[model samples]
Target: MANTSGNAYGLTALCPIINGHTNDSNPLYKAAGESHDKEVRRILQALPLNQESPFANTDNTYLARLFILNDVFFQQGNDFKRDQLKSKYLCFNSNFHGELEPYLTSLWNNNENQVREIWQHCVAFESVSNANDFVRYIKSCQLTTTLFFNGSNDQPVAEQLKALYVKQMFSEFVLTQQGKSAAELKQAFKYFLQRVQLNDVKSPSWKPGQTEVAL
Candidate 1:
């Protein structure tokens, strides 16, 4: 738990990690406080990169902010953050609490049943319609490859069906108001390509000669 004094906006400044703060805004009489503040500033200067927030006033606030920070870093496109969140996306059973890295890696590599099961169970994801169509298109490719999924996934299949409906809906239901932007469609296509390139999890449809060519 770190302590924070009021900063410029009086937001209990948590960032730019520091101990005691400054502005020349306040006049102080104690030389000891000044010395302590200088030492704190020195420590902060020395540990810029790895510094923690000094205004995580409560335990819950600290945890909440930490989670947000993790999300920010993840979304910033950092390789480490991408890997970390991808681990969260591809691995990690939210219901079962335990050591995640090994269990998830094992499940991803060795257990398609579990991986598909976990994947199918996700309900909170943004259902990107164009991407979903592209995924189904790839899945429909008759290359000797197959991504085995749980047979019990009727709902998941329905969801895929709905995504198909969504892709078509833009044209049919929306009366040609306009479809997804070209950039959005390209991003969807790129995402599908990336999925097809899973290293240890070779997808059959991904192999050459299995799918149709678009001229």
Candidate 2:
């Protein structure tokens, strides 16, 4: 942490960089700051956030990497893959998209657009600075990940499977928009299905009575 800043002013030395409330020490902030300088900013840019904190810590970069990994991983599996021409990433990118839609909508509806924009600017994660491009990244993914679970009459599994088809279409749309032919979509489908088969392999198969049965 900042080369210990000498024996007398140890922690007091780092007040200019990190929030003293969180770090509270010289060696901690120093070491963290050095690591952050190298990794966090670049990863945040790759995640393509609006702005990167010059002094973000290792924790922030680690999380950004996880997001990128999840993006690629999701593109690989079958059932695990998203359904739609778009994905969870895109739809969620919408300024106000989320599970708490009703509440957000209630606010959005009753308020004037000007007031709504102000509130959005002042409150909520989406409203705040596009920290690390968080909202855009999520919206890009969400365009396709909707469950669309009918919840009407079919069993849960049926509805869930219904979503897979949509996710497949989503991949195709992405592939197409990027200039891949329709045939390439078929290829990606095959690639992901193979991954799904591999994931299936991780679980033991069923036996008449000696197996873990799911309901």
Indicate the TM-score of model 1.
Answer: 0.15
Candidate 1 off by > 4 Å:
1-10, 13-34, 50-215
Candidate 2: how many backbone clashes? 37
TM-score of each: 0.15, 0.17
Error of 1 at 106 (Å): 29
Q: In angstroms, how far off is 151's CA in candidate 1?
A: 48
Residue 163 local lDDT, model 2: 47
Total clashing pairs for each candidate: 2, 37
> Model 1 over residues 86-142: C-alpha lDDT tens digits?
221111111111222332233344433332322232222223133343233222321
For candidate 2, lDDT tens digit of each residue in 1-215?
Answer: 22111111111000011112222256765666543222322333444232232111111111112211112233666557454422111111111112322322333333334222222211122432333333332333332322222212322222333344435545564665576678986797686565444334222222211222231
Candidate 2 worst ten-residue window by lDDT? 8-17
